[model samples]
Target chain A: MHSPGDKDNGEIEALIQMMSRLPGLGPRSARRIVLHLIRRRAGQMAQLATLLASVAESSRECLACGNVTQSDICPICQDPSRATGEICVVTDVADLWALERGRAFRGRYHVLGGSLSALDEIGPEDLRIPELINRITDENVTEVILALSATVEGQTTAHYIADALAPTQVAITGLAQGVPIGGELDYLDDGTITAALRARRKF
Target chain B: MHSPGDKDNGEIEALIQMMSRLPGLGPRSARRIVLHLIRRRAGQMAQLATLLASVAESSRECLACGNVTQSDICPICQDPSRATGEICVVTDVADLWALERGRAFRGRYHVLGGSLSALDEIGPEDLRIPELINRITDENVTEVILALSATVEGQTTAHYIADALAPTQVAITGLAQGVPIGGELDYLDDGTITAALRARRKF
Candidate 1:
């Protein structure tokens, strides 16, 4: 019998292998997903294939900010109303999208594509640090908000950027570290509690 | 940044929505998968799309036992060596594939597609129960081993099948329920412990 895992079922097995390579999916879940898709082949499966092809053909990085986009420039970078003399620097497009979902930041963004990692040998040049410095003067930016993760590598990258852009004289700031909205102190981590206590402001 | 969630990025948003509908994926993970796919568009993404298309076009249910196959008859059903006069019945193709992976069951399989569910108004006609009965007689089967789940619906279906096949005078059996291999007694539930004790045999 040509079992689902058998080499004879090449396409199905290959599809499952490919799916398992995606983030948050493993071989078992990939097999289940493939089976579900196969059952709905006429509807979701066909549509998914079409969408993947189209997205693959069109999707590209925004030349200005390293954000994912269909055009050379992302919509936020192209929007005149959003050019508010402020740029929120993020470590990745996912983080940029997350900040956009909050709808609190109206300024444009600069996606570094990844954070500084000495162990991985990633440096400033490997990221968009040079472009960010150029944007400070070219775009007449007044403030730069570092909305990077609180991880050590993220902080190191933030510090490196702040030092590199020192000559540009742009006002550099970072996202506040404290208790998140609706977060309970009992469940909070030690570092978070310490940071929250140290950054206490007028209540 | 036409935010990925925005209507402007229609294809990307649609792809994420479709992916989120998969068994183990949600919106957040779907977005991550889509981003990962887009990043590897030239290679993995393209290959995945091609594989999905091919599988969707070729895959179908095995006419004999309802197992998923690329042709009308599944390989297991078509194989002469698998006609061992013993048919192992399962609730779904996933279960059938699981049994195949073990490589212990050399006989053929009968996929019921789903178990009996009174709440869902599913009846014997809805599943492949009638076809299974016909196969027992036509294939000169001697034993029917029910490899159903431990769920109430699975047990109900198994009992119903046994009663229906009683007239055929075929030997009917079920999978033994006990502590799973490598299971700790402390971690096992009450039902498993009771069944294991009742069915204890000389080691």
Candidate 2:
């Protein structure tokens, strides 16, 4: 039997360590979350565990577009109406989910898994770039929207994909750069302000 | 089959909602965490699920001390070496865990579940105060240290417990009010500075 002073709580410690590895949670937050879960073990904890297990066992990446789903093909890729001759390519499934939340794009998506990173030695072959190229020709795609971030890797990947798809004659476009929908001029960065000025339209 | 803009991802949405309810996590963080878990479903996510299930099914409050445990009694209460005639009382299991992390106290602990709250109609019967008084003679306890918070409810509970234990002939004590170990005098609150001055000891 160990005293409270002993640092040998196996299960609880393991839970905290795992939770802390999550994106937004640190060690302190993880400990607080674990304690909260323990207190609500009969209700929320049990429900969360059940949902996690279900998702873990069932959720799989779409074979066509790389979006997460309970089947071989994700719901977005499987939906026939979404094949509107346009494909929005993103770096990861999270980005895909974010686009889904916006509910403005009535098209499919291509998840690249990650951007081209020279430091990490990640290249076109490492992501779903080859799959995305094949998708353009196979699905009679008329346009491909590069919805990647404004980072160096994102730009490099977008340019590489555009050059590759040039022969296929598909209209390749990138997201417009300017002030964000709800952005204040005071908070807008210098680079964004410059881009917005240079890309001014005759409105 | 749903499109990228579809708002009917039931399972995924449910998972996000449940995760947001955890302490220190809001809806945005929950969405990020859910997407991360889904992406890592084959590894960390699966491990998390297994651990959550195991803990949810097994972890229970210690019958003797109200601390979280996997068995009837917590390790602290079961450990014969921890019968040091001193018991530190806390308002919650999280408080007990916090004290355990410090690892300076060698004695056992008693969890009160919550403090006295007249507004919420909580009294001694709502907490484990009666059990604490009974443990004095049962455990041959010589000292009862109130390690509750400095809040109004905590003080009220501490005072009530002290009065109740006055008949047991056991020494009732509260944690010292002073500047925290690493706190600076300049940044310290007026109440703490006053407490520290009143309790000043000669070198």
Candidate 3:
């Protein structure tokens, strides 16, 4: 950390080195993005710092779904109208927003936190799979939509969940979104997203 | 800012407000992202924060191309192999990375900082247009590949630049990525990216 009087080249180098470690960002890009944010600190960076600190203390995971929330339960789970007997499942929180962007889905969501990965040792216990089953009976859910990725791991996890919930007789489906050969929900366009949702067929 | 004894609500709210302002992120996504980062602070989040701080200090705009850099010139400009006499002109630093991911182009790049927009009182003077004109001759740049988005503003800026650098005798081409109507480079796949790059034609 730089002292009050030490805004020198060394300090700057240290900062850039640290920033390079961020996900989706390399050292070169990190250095660039950080500088841009800092130059606008008077208008943006300072505020980002303050928010980072505060959110650090106040936020938590949704108890029912894996969605991140400030309160014990996320807003989506709290809304009575959202309990539409259907819970769309996703890999990460980012995917949830992609669906929300089109303002289409009205049902609630159950974030898996991550997919079933044998290599990473990520199993059903690591995800919200157990909780998802419980929600089916507790919420009188009729369908469990699997809006997961089409990756090897993603499909594997989807099949596992389907088998797990087979006893409940719930209609399982996926986002017929024509998700590219290998793509995340985050990158799809609004129209593609709309089409994917509309064409969603039963799995 | 709050004293040690103050309740944490205000601090948390402040953080949410600042995060809401990030591109493609609103209060809700910001809150979730912040929460996710905090929960994994010891692992991923810690690394991200440390890196954020590091880049914040060392990162600066490349003197030659306006790309983010830790020194006078960015690595792209510094690399001898990248001097392919073709300089891809883009709207921002993000676009540069998107281009890099495609790995189809062997040329250096120029970050215009932003597009020319009269609605926001932004003009040629507001962007790096003057610098771009200067680079054509300085770098012996044979081509200026316009890889901007399909937004009305993006096209307008591209056209404006093509006209401004008319006398430079540089080949003025745009990425024919047939980029979806409103697609961004970041959202594209490597193959789609390559296709677009390969199909590029004269402006």
Candidate 4:
């Protein structure tokens, strides 16, 4: 006969499998993370649960810049001080968060949902290219920073964006090539990000 | 006014806050984690959500051992293969995970929920001490491995459990000294944990 607590084994098993899908996390790690969360429920787990429920309901892509935001515009775009006529474009929200952690950049950001995926049929339309063009004139953006990944696709995308915005007369720039930042963000110290941001140059 | 996808800010904010609460993670990291999860919704986030929802609904305390599981009797307790007449008591599930990661221990584990905290008003009843004592003879346990931290509270709790189990004839042992673990990273080289496990001494 199954007991009261045993009833949730199926649920826990499903949860473990789901957690296993996370990046850098496998089924074993997923089970461990879930167990840890459950054990600390009153403090960390409860708060996480409420947040997960709410975010699962409220999270959406920003209409203008494509940043993950709770509102139509991300905090960076909404902030008046950040509208210094500069829009730093990045591949994903993780890169945006890395920039934010450095706290060195004063301008805003435009997240390009993803890089141009040739094998995956991802093109400019698949990204925020059009929205970025519209935002330039609409918001008096004087400069566009191509803070994309250093991968082949990232560079191709950067060149594509630079060419697309060629007529806009905007001061286009990209993060420095010597700084080494594309796939790995968690490993870089805060100061390295700050340095890279400081040394960004025209694309 | 209202953008097409501007409806879910509240949920996103809640998720960001929850992610921030994780150890070694902050607001920025949480935002990134949420965004990463969202982008992979089909294969990752959806599964994670379902798992979280179900685990949130069904998780409970392991009545006999204090391990957080989905049943009154945990898998370790119910497993006939684990009926080796030995129980390795620990402070939390993380320790158990650490032990499992090593693939060293063959017997079952009894999590203590937490160490006895005088400052926190935690006594023997607050932990699974009495339950652990009851399992000694009932399970015909030959040894009790006190796989607890080397902290003052951990040592004290170990001593208390050892003292409580004194009436029984089971051999009581503990994890060795000079090896420290706070369950912060959980990424120690397997050999280190294995060495520590092998070097374990009597309490």
Cα deviation of A38 in candidate 4 (Å)?
1.5
Clashing pairs for model 3 are: A15-B54, A15-B55, A16-B54, A16-B55, A18-B51, A19-B51, A51-B15, A177-A196, B177-B196
How does model 4 fare in lDDT? 0.75
Candidate RMSDs in order:
6.2, 6.0, 11.6, 5.3
Model 1 segments beyond 4 Å from truth? A1-7, A179-203, B1-7, B179-203
Chain A TM per prediction: 0.83, 0.82, 0.87, 0.88
Could you tell me every candidate's TM-score relative to the true structure?
0.84, 0.85, 0.54, 0.72
Deviation of model 4 at B115, angstroms: 3.8
Write one digit per residue (lDDT tens) for candidate 4, span B86-188: 7999888777767777877878899887889999999999887888888898888999998877778888898999898888978999877436555321455
On the 0 to 100 scale, the lDDT of residue A36 in model 1 is 92
lDDT of 3 by residue, B89-131 (tens): 8888777867887889988898888888888999898898899
What is candidate 2's lDDT per residue for B81-166, written digit by digit as tens? 78999898888877777666655566889999998999999989989999998999999998887877767778788889988998
Error of 4 at A6 (Å): 6.3
| TM-score ranking of the models | 2, 1, 4, 3
lDDT of each: 0.79, 0.78, 0.75, 0.75
Compared with the true structure, what per-residue lDDT tens digits does model 4 show for residues A1-203? Answer: 33334343577667767656555567656666777777675666666655565555555677777777766666666666776888999887778778777898898889887889789899999898999999889999999988877778888999999999999999998887445645554346678878777888878
- i-RMSD values for every candidate model: 3.8, 3.6, 9.3, 5.0
What does candidate 1's lDDT look like per residue over A1-203, in tens digits? 34454324567778888888898898788988998998998888988998898888888899899988877887788777898998888888887776676566778899997889989999999998999999999999988887766677787888899888888878887766674654432334556644543443321
Candidate 2 residue runs with Cα over 4 Å from true position: A1-8, A179-203, B1-9, B179-203
Could you give me the TM-score of model 4 versus the true structure?
0.72
Model 3's DockQ?
0.08
Off by over 4 Å in 4: A1-21, A24-33, A72-87, A97-109, A116-122, A134-143, A149-155, A168-203, B1-14, B80-84, B98-108, B116-123, B137-145, B149-159, B170-203
Residue A30 miss distance in model 2 (angstroms): 1.2
Model 2: reference contacts kept, as a fraction:
0.59
List the TM values for chain B, per candidate: 0.83, 0.84, 0.84, 0.86
In candidate 3, what are the lDDT values of residues A1-203, reduced to their tens digit? 22343223444456556545434446655546555675674456645654554455456677888766666776677776787898999998778767877778889899998899889999998998999999999989998889888788889999999999999999999889578867777777767877887788899
